[model samples]
Target: MRRGASRDKPGARVVQPPVVYVHGLGSASTVYHAHVAADPRLATRRQLFVDLPGHGISDRPSGFRYTLEDHADALAAALDAAGAVGADIAGHSMGGAVAIVLAARRPDLVSRLVLTEANLDPNPVPKAGSSGIASYNEDAFVRGGSFAAVLERVDPLWAATMRLADPLALHRTAVGLVRGTRPTMRHLLMSLPIDRTYLVGDVDNDLPGRAELAASGVRVEVVPNAGHNIMFDNPQAFINAVAGEAPRVTADAYKS
Candidate 1:
């Protein structure tokens, strides 16, 4: 749990609430280590890294639905386990979406939010013969060998994790991601009472909606020379962005 600057030091500044880092699909808490370790601001603040249910070392309950809200609920429980009242949250991709839902559904558990390339639309692009999650072929994906290839290139550790993850849990979560719930990502981002920031990689061409988000008054930051996986491509830049030290840019350039 709690790690950062010692509170016993004389004249210690007021302690900032913990910052919880949530990883995206097929990713583990280790993805945030580089950025967290290098960020000086986090040295004095509590940092919590969550391994969402069905991913990493977390348990994979057979009855779980793995919906965005489900993931949020699990995260809320994790916070309770940590004895944290509320925390600043930084989430990437699927994790970002989960954070949005958490901030909307359980405002008491979130103080601030940092969403990096979170899915904003309820309907995701078609994949594997379906425009939504309804048609996802989990067994085929796992058995076809494509998932393995993708994981191997992205991160061998992730590949290993995938091999062990509950197939149903992973499939259901993926489906839930594509078929977002009633309070969609867009609504959650716009309505949450807490402070919200959106960060994207310069090369994340898939995120064409950042401009719209910026127009809505949300602060947006871009990590240069990076892609969808900002932390993996430019960990230092991600840390800088999270620390509010990264240079700001108008979202006009990212408009579709």
Candidate 2:
């Protein structure tokens, strides 16, 4: 943990084993703070809201590569330092991808997985979001006004956190997401012999390789009245999914 992990401010009584929450790109772990506080079953469990390097209150190291594996390794060290091994892990979008890599690369750190709108595809088109950020050279992004343009173009909700991230780190991480890891996060996720659950918005339920994921024994749940940002759009569903009381909508039902 070169820059150290960001955690919820201490004081709450720790009852059950700690659970880790990782945020997506251009966002901080604190995004889950309110949602966690709202859930009774999860409120008792210790919250390790980690702000991956280059995001939130964490430091931005110029030397860091900001790749998925790099983020996972750093997360592994942070979990070890916090003595939060074997914790249930939940991640959103880019964070979900990182969590998959973490569970695979360092299985000891994760017990179960709850992913929200994770991109299972190896390569995304280089037009917007991560790929858009990756489309430019670092120099053009970091020094040029490209970063500023991105901040201005995104919705205020995202820009609020994206503004905190280091341009260089953000660019590299996006590039890594586009380039993908050696084994690919999707492959690692499918092969993991753990209690895996993936939550996608009902409107966007047509997730890539969804049938394969279900066939691989992964629980694919749909969060109705929600979009990519599940926590924000429907906190109750997210909490239910995390608490293991998620809606029992069958695969056939979801598709129909």
Candidate 3:
């Protein structure tokens, strides 16, 4: 299992057979920290909350192309960096898309896979109002141009989204989204193959597949009372669905 920054923090315990969590677009690993922290069942599992390159404290190299494959490679590198050859994997939104790619490309590294609010459509679903733009873009464009111009464009939208997201995470996400460039995200989105078995928020504006995913042998669980940010709005529902579907092996393997 891989270790994360949480381990070195005060009162942190060693994560066994770690669980790597990939955050959604414009967000950092911290997005799932509280939700994961609240769950005792996942305590023993190490948490590798990736900040992805160019987000959070990680390096923001010039000419970085943010794509699904790039994000997956970042995850793979993170695992290798942590010496976690085998671990459980989970992601949200764009991160979810990346997680699916990672599992598909390197099945051996992933013991289990859980994706929340995964936008597998390969095309952006229209969202209304600021919450839509703020939730998705508006920040990345401005900041990604250059570090000096980054926050100049990021501040206003970041503040606005914070107000709408009663819980504060929406605001945090806005900031994270501003950190990366759109070309990278779009490139990654375009590169996605639209395949995998995972869960998506039933309330999510995008993804339109419950029947197809199930019929295709991909387990799809719908988290109710939640939108794209299921981990924040409906943690229990997300947890239950994940617990039910995300196991190291198939159901038959666990039955006996």
Which candidate has the highest TM-score of all?
2
Model 1: lDDT of residue 161: 51
Model 2 global lDDT (CA atoms, 0 to 1) = 0.82
Assess the local accuracy of residue 145 in candidate 2 as a C-alpha lDDT between 0 and 100: 92
lDDT of 3 by residue, 127-149 (tens): 42223444534344344433223
Extract clashing residue pairs from model 2. none
Query: What would you estimate as the lDDT of candidate 3?
Result: 0.52
How high is the lDDT of residue 6 in model 3?
Answer: 20
What is the per-residue lDDT of model 2 for residues 1-256, given as tens digits with 9 covering 90 to 100?
4643668533257655567888888889887545565476787777788888898887789999998889988888888888887888888988899999999988888989989987666678554489888888899999999999999988899999999899999999898888777687888898999988999998766687677777777889878899889888888888887777775444444332
C-alpha lDDT values of all predictions: 0.69, 0.82, 0.52
Candidate 3 Cα misplacement greater than 4 A, ranges: 1-16, 128-140, 143-197, 204-206, 244-256
Winner on TM-score between 1 and 3 is 1
Counted clashes in each candidate structure:
3, 0, 6
Root mean square deviation (Cα) for candidate 3: 8.7
Question: Per-residue error at 77 for model 1, in Å?
Answer: 0.8
- Output the better candidate (1/2) by lDDT: 2
